[model samples]
Target: MGIGNWELGIGNWELGIGNFFLVFLVFLVFLVFPIPPFPHTPYRGSS
Candidate 1:
């Protein structure tokens, strides 16, 4: 039972890391090429 739980934890950790990298990659892509519809300075109301 303990070994099974350990394996499950490792699997979940790996999955989490994979998701983190995927999100990071997507973020980089967006930064490199932002969409036209969305305003660049959404945070600043002055735009």
Candidate 2:
């Protein structure tokens, strides 16, 4: 059943204890130090 698989995916993603911390850690790292500044600041005096 298509609907059943969809539910399973959601359940696993939310309930499973594996990789949860890894995902959180990765997000924290990104939040702490972003690769590229969001919205991209324009160069000073360029315009």
Q: What's the CA RMSD for each of the models?
A: 10.8, 10.9
Best by TM-score: 1
Q: CA lDDT, every prediction?
A: 0.59, 0.51
Index of the highest-lDDT prediction: 1
* Model 1 weakest 10-residue run by lDDT: 38-47
Instruction: Please identify model 2 stretches exceeding 4 Å from their true place.
Output: 1-15, 37-47
Q: Using Cα atoms with residue i matched to residue i, what is each candidate's TM-score against the true structure? A: 0.50, 0.40
Q: Lowest lDDT 10-mer window, candidate 2?
A: 38-47
Supply every candidate's count of residue pairs whose N, Cα or C atoms clash at under 3 angstroms.
0, 0
